[model samples]
Target: MAVVNRRGAQRIRNGHPWVFRSDLERAPAVAAGFVRVEEYTGAPLGFALWSPQSEISLRHVSADASRAPDAAWWHEQLRTAIARRAPLATESNAYRLVHGEGDGLPSLVVDRYGDALVVQLLSAGVNAWTETIVASLQELTGCTGILARNDPAARDREGLPREVRLLHGDVPRVIEVVEHGVRYLAAPWDGQKTGAFLDQRENRVLIGSLARGRALDCFAYHGSFALHLADRAEHVTAVDISAPALARVHEHAQRNGLTNIEPVEGDAFDVLRAWYREGRRFDTIVVDPPAFAKNRNAIEGALRGYKDINLQAMRLLAPGGLLFTASCSFHLSRGLFFEMLQEASADSGRRFALRAITGQPLDHPELITVPETGYLKGALLEAMG
Candidate 1:
């Protein structure tokens, strides 16, 4: 059993599962499988899924140094993860099953949409056990189809090739899914985040319930909130930069026999500014933009962008209008996001009542120890006269 030299031992002891290359004394020739982690003094620490090509050299799978990363261990872990998500299946047809390390299975995320399973491998250790995980998913979920969308940029750091492949039964181009009683057709390859924004399922339901009178859904990719809002609101205008996404929204509305949605394709900021100039106002607004601040260096600029966009949107809100704003950037702290929103509200001379503050859905588990795991932050505010 090859051990994790010295520094790797301390990181493991510290509760971090990753084993970086620099922590090694000398590179050992080991196949992509379970490897022993040990101290320089030759004391065994744990067992990890080993991969030579990944920046995350190993993923700690078991604290007991003897257990191997084999089919039995993989099935056990996958079954446990599935059981945890069993409750979600009742709540929504589209939901995340395994969230990588958050589920104690590093570098692996499996989202279930109806009978199909979408798997993403984010690191070398997970890639090594891909077959095991896939087989277990099929056996446990009785899933008809399994697709791999391992295209995250982080995979490059693991020296793994990005790929989208079908691993099991045939999958349709568009699959019907229902969330909070609203139906949607999610495309596999084309849709964002493994065929639809399952992360926004609960948020859309919230928007639908709160929507009334005139509503606007900005940066509304694929009309998640727009379609739902249109179902209950007097009218809804959905804006997005991607014409295709807007088209999909329209198609979805048509499929559901809904006609209260208006799809607009343009830059969200420009459209919001134009609406403000036209003196057009809405009773409720949903501002769910893409990540503006991906890295720390861009945080200042991103904050300004978020503030500017939000300021324009807030200005167009009629008295007592509700605003649901969100930030998906892990680098953008909740404190910073709230501060930016406060600046926007103050600049617009608006007194807002905070209705709610939330993070991602239950499936997107946030570990208490790792703050980075909590990326999605949101606030529901109402502009009071």
Candidate 2:
């Protein structure tokens, strides 16, 4: 059994599933797996995944104080998470089936891309059940193949080796997917976070629906946003720091038969600054950069970066134009994100209307109780000046 201090008990009671190493009074003797969680006085709290080696010692799995979660219980949780995402079959073939703590299956992430499934066991406790998880997924998804994208640094902290191997069936190097009628390719073998940023699916749809006039997609990695904007916008400028990524953008645009997309190679910050100084304006602009803050220590600088790019984007926004800015940094809180945009608006000296506050798609469920489950947030702003 794993024992926790008073503070840890209170944290679990408050709906937080993480019990830090500092809060853990005693961990289970086993190397890894589920264990009974108890308070200092031996009062049963729940069942949690006991990862003795990681900084997060206990990850709460079930609140059933009486029953320990067995293999059947975990199977049901996986099934429930999969069933919750059933409605998305019609909208797109690519989506997140299991969102770790968001789905009450902590430290386990399963993303589906077309015929393949990409899984990440982020914690030692979850890693122990990799076989069970893969077996259940093969039965549940009936997909062509399952690949383990377990190369995340988090595994290093958990005392697990990093690897990207085919777990079951046959997964291809490249998988094509469609989201809201926009088709794109996913490199499940060697691509960004489960091949693509599935969390931004809804945001892409929202921006595409309202795209018009000259649009600019800053930090357009593989041109996901640019592809959507080109469908409705008169012209589109897809900017990226890497010329190779821009090359992929050109290929994506060409494959989609979108001739209006122009790939621009440059840093988004420098380009935005140059555009505003040159009196260059766009009717629509999307500033979806890579996570500026990966940890708490970087939050201060990340906010500055966010504010600066947003401020420049606001200046380049024509009257009655749209600006869709987003941040994927979990370290940057949603409240802080809104506050940063407000500060940017004040600095821009422009009247901005908050058309919509965007968030993750239906597939990427963000629980209110667990802030870590959610990271993607954005705003659809209109320049009213």
Candidate 3:
């Protein structure tokens, strides 16, 4: 085993859980699948996924080097991951069991919506164990089907071949899963990342409670937040760039016999600006745009984008109405997000009352040291008179 430098070993020892190329003592000619990370003194540190391209460089599989990244280990991890969700009896049917590195299983995610499992093999290490992982998921969860949503972009980053196929069981074109008493048609085979945003389950329920009068869901992909508002609010206008996503939302609403949802297909910023210009006011507005900042460099531009949309949303909100805004950019800190919101309120000349500040569901557990893990942050506030 080639030795990893002192700094990398120290970082792993301190529980940061990733080693970069700069931290290596000597380069080992190991395959992309897995390699042993050791200290300069030849002391074994952990097993890591060796990525030559990404700065993440090495994703630690396990601190214990003895544990091989194979079928037996995967079966055990899959069993333990499923067992961890025993408390969520109803939620188990449609939830994320293994959240990549969050569950100590780096570069792999398993989300079960009813009897179907959506898997994302994000790294060479996980991809190597794909067959075993799929089999274990089926045997452990009794899932009727397993769909590999291995999008090409993520695989290319890992220097692995992109593959999308039904590894095991039966996955239909669209699978139905009930979430908080509402049935959601998840298209794992043909839909977005893992068929649905199961991570936002709890947040959507919270949005349902906050909905009132007319609501606007900007970048409301598939209407998870918008559709939830249908039963709670007077009406909902869902805006997204993807016409197909809007169509899916419309389809979901129609399936549920809901008629109060208005699927609007257009750029969120333009639509918000037009609504503001037309003096079209909403009682509640949710600006849950996709990640604007992927890295530190784009943060300034992303912040400006966030501020502009929020400023417009606040301006179009009626007095005492709500503004539920969020940024999924891990690069954007909670303090910075709050500061942006305050500035947006100031720019809009509106007094804002902070009702609640929330984050991703419990499934997406955030380690204190891993601040990047706690990227999903949002505020539920009311525009005061």
Top model number, TM-score: 2
- Ordered from best to worst TM-score, the candidate numbers read 2, 1, 3
| Candidate 2 minimal-lDDT segment of 10 residues | 66-75
lDDT of 2 by residue, 136-198 (tens): 888887888999999999999999999999999999888888888888888998899989888
Off by over 4 Å in 2: none
- 296 Cα displacement, candidate 3 (Å): 2.7
**Residue clash pairs of candidate 1:** 4-38
Clash totals, every prediction: 1, 0, 1
Question: Can you give the TM-score per candidate against the true fold?
Answer: 0.94, 0.97, 0.93
Candidate 3 C-alpha error for residue 274, in Å: 2.6
For model 3, what is the error of residue 25's alpha carbon versus the real structure, in angstroms, after optimal superposition?
2.0
RMSD of 1: 1.8
Predicted structure 1, TM vs. truth: 0.94
For model 1, the superposed segments whose C-alpha errors exceed 4 Å read 1-7
The 10 consecutive residues of candidate 3 with the worst lDDT sum are 84-93
* Cα lDDT of model 1 by residue, 1-385, tens digit: 5456667887788777777777776555877667777777888777877778766677776887666567988888888877877777776788989988778788788988889989998877678777878889989999999999888888888777888889889777889888877788888765788888887777888878888899999998888888888877899999999988888889888877898999999998999999899999999899999999989999999999999999998999989888999989999999999999999999999799899997888888887765656789998999898
